[model samples]
Target: MTLSTVNPDFWKGRRVLLTGHSGFKGAWAALWLCRMGAEVTGVSLPPEGNFSLYDSIKDQLTLNSNFIDIRDAEKLNAVVKKSNPEIILHMAAQALVRRSYREPVNTYETNVMGTANLLEAMRDLAELKAALIITSDKVYRNNEDGHAFRETDPLGGDDPYSASKAACEITTASFAKSFFNDKGIPIATARAGNVIGGGDFSEDRLIPDIWRAAREGESVTLRYPGATRPWQHVLESVSGYLVYLQALAGDDGAHLPKSLNFGPQGGEVVTVGEIALEVQKAFGIDSNWSLVNSAQPPEKSYLALDASLAHKALGWQSKWAPSETLTKTVEWYKAFSETPDIYSFTLSQIDEYEDIS
Candidate 1:
């Protein structure tokens, strides 16, 4: 069976409090929730980088946004209490690996402590039915293999950013054991790899950097041209998260105190150079790119996620293939390139994803 975009009434009148709703993936998820007819309350800091997807859809969606820091437990707790949300999706964190290297302390505080603060705040909320904590595929220790990372794989990270995410995973498991399992909250952790789509202007990411370079008539730079990853679209990961939530809300036994990995379809892994070539073709640009001249930070050479469990248990697999995902990404950037109407473009994609259901 294939996965389709969910119907609007599926989430009608449901309340969802999403932290870090202003980030790239979070913004896309927020727009989709609004389309699915959920009352969405967004809590996070203001947009920091270029044209933000959040800023684009703030007025269009039924969003109650509050500018605050997740690290501040007092503020976060107050907001969680006020919302009394039935579903919670925690996406707030310092997400960059290179940046984490630069600010290790901030990374730990935001990723680990921020998670603990949210779980603590939700502890007393009796109405809360399910909570999905968004972590990274990087949480697993990579031994430079093309094989996929499994759910029960060893959770360890060499770098500050990945290590901090690993810490969050441990905290989540401990919290679920200590309280959630018996309390019937049924918390789950999500780890998805290399999600790419529109409206992302973050640093140190591939698609955004490629888009920027192509727009400026310059070639993209690659530090690790041969590195490989599980490249999936944003909606692919979003669909898995929604299905997991649906299972948790329906049959608690299905998702009780568990962790799941969402990756692209089997045999979908592609090398960085191949993806760059596809991106160039999508952009229709003859622009060139080369390796970095100076030294670069060390990163894993290869990493992938074993999504077989998600397929077997949740019946969830990637809806869009890698080529389709890259095409969609290029299309979004092309629309923004021709006319920088980020708000309209973001809403259109949300509608597009929902219509697939």
Candidate 2:
């Protein structure tokens, strides 16, 4: 599905309620929705750092935004009631693994209970046609083998962040079956792989860490250099979400599945070390990385997702290969480092991505 083929009339004048609009992926989704002429209401906490994509584009686009935590059920419900949104895209969560180890209770409360609160609030909105709950690919149990995970794979997580997301999947399923399934509102959960993009200064992530190290004139540190993961551009995953939401809006929950995975193809899987080297070369920096020989929380050494279900069902496929993904990501950061107009640069990239299809 190319960008030209996407019907603009479908999203024009559509009311969308997006959670976590201040974060990396959420900000990208909000930008695309705004370009499509959707009336957007964003609910999320304030930006974690001084440099944020949300800050760059907030004034450029007209949107209804609130700085509220998802755990605040009373305020969240009130916002949802006031927005009267037709579509809900839930992306708010405690997304880091290392931080989860230090604050497990906070992770669970935000990921699991926060999801429940959103769904509960949506139950009364008669105009809501579809709700897509965004979860992580870490929800699957990893045996360190090379087998790619399927939708039917056993749901398990060793870390608090992953476990909380797994519990969210369960909660979304239960809510779908008990409440929305019969009420004519389609609720589905999306699990996406490791997403890399520009303007993401989140700590403990690969791309941001590499950019930081390069700026500081230091070598990049890797805790798990040899671990393999499915890597794709942020736009790829967000495109999949838009396609899934379009399907739900058109069908009204008649034939779509409850859960789907949006990830790279089989050949796009690469190791952490490979990503570091590729980014280094892309940014014209020397390759300098050292392995950390210290204790860290347990994480999967090998992880990948089988997106054949999404392909056969929704005609969704990743357009960018691993190498191209790296190049585009580095290019974005390099442009930002050289130019002051990040909002225009980002919109240009989005326009370029839309023309690719």
Candidate 3:
């Protein structure tokens, strides 16, 4: 099972509908697809904050941008009908755990029903060949047992965000069984671990917090410093999605995996505190962290994913090692500040990644 590198020939002139095109991972996916010559149509809410990655690179992306709430079924359906996309990459959702706690209704309405809306919109689109729903690694029924989760593990979520994603997985499965599979549309879900990369300035994330604190000459506060997580570069996870999507495009639904995990290999366990130190060192700064917290929400203490399924099925393995992931991610942020032409600089990184394969 040799999973080939993403083929520009396969993506060239392909019609793609990418949801959540303004978010961190969505922006990266849009960039990659646009570079590979896909006719991309993006559907997402406006990118927020003063330093949104999508805003910085939107001018560089050659795609049709549609600002619509996924929760609004009618509008989303209308957009999907007008675009008539062949492939749908459903990445739109309320993705923050802390935010989910505060806005449970919005989280459920978006992550759960929002996903349902996308599939429902595409129910009759004969042009749609395949769809890959992006979910999170936190969907497992983790009791801090220190065992890495596999595709068949029991799905559970203590938090609103993870629970909604788990529900999304179920919704996607039901749609496939009831409609899409019979229509020969290959639908699959990918559960990926935590990703660290450049151009991500979201609040409450480790890398952004470290970068912000260092810029202000302050110490980063860590609420879950002792927790262990499986972390990889954002490119690793995104590349896995593209490769998996390519496979689905070439195959029928029956024999392929319905769900899979994209994560780091074994022995990549790194704690939050360790990551903070490593990121600081990568940025050429001293490690300064505070272990104090005020009303930090509940999260998993130990999280890992067994990606052997992705390897054995698609022959996909992580390209960048842990240290290399840290270095390259830091390099991107540094270049974002120093390099005036951030678009070319970002594309250069993508070119470098493709060259690695």
Candidates by lDDT, descending order: 3, 2, 1
Against the reference, the lDDT scores of all candidates come to 0.84, 0.88, 0.89
Q: State every prediction's TM-score relative to the real structure.
A: 0.95, 0.97, 0.98
Tell how far residue 177 is off in model 1, in angstroms: 0.9
Query: In model 3, where do residues sit more than 4 Å from their true spots?
Result: 1-3
After superposing candidate 2 on the true structure, give the runs of residues whose Cα lies further than 4 Å from its correct spot.
1-6
- Rank ordering of all candidates by TM-score, starting from the highest: 3, 2, 1
Model 1 Cα lDDT, one tens digit per residue, 53-142 = 677667777888988998999999999999999988889999999999899999999999999999999999979888899999999988
RMSD of each: 1.8, 1.5, 1.2
| TM-score, cand. 1 vs. native | 0.95
In every candidate, how many clashes are there? 2, 0, 0
Q: After superposition, how far is residue 152 of candidate 1 from its true place, in Å?
A: 1.2
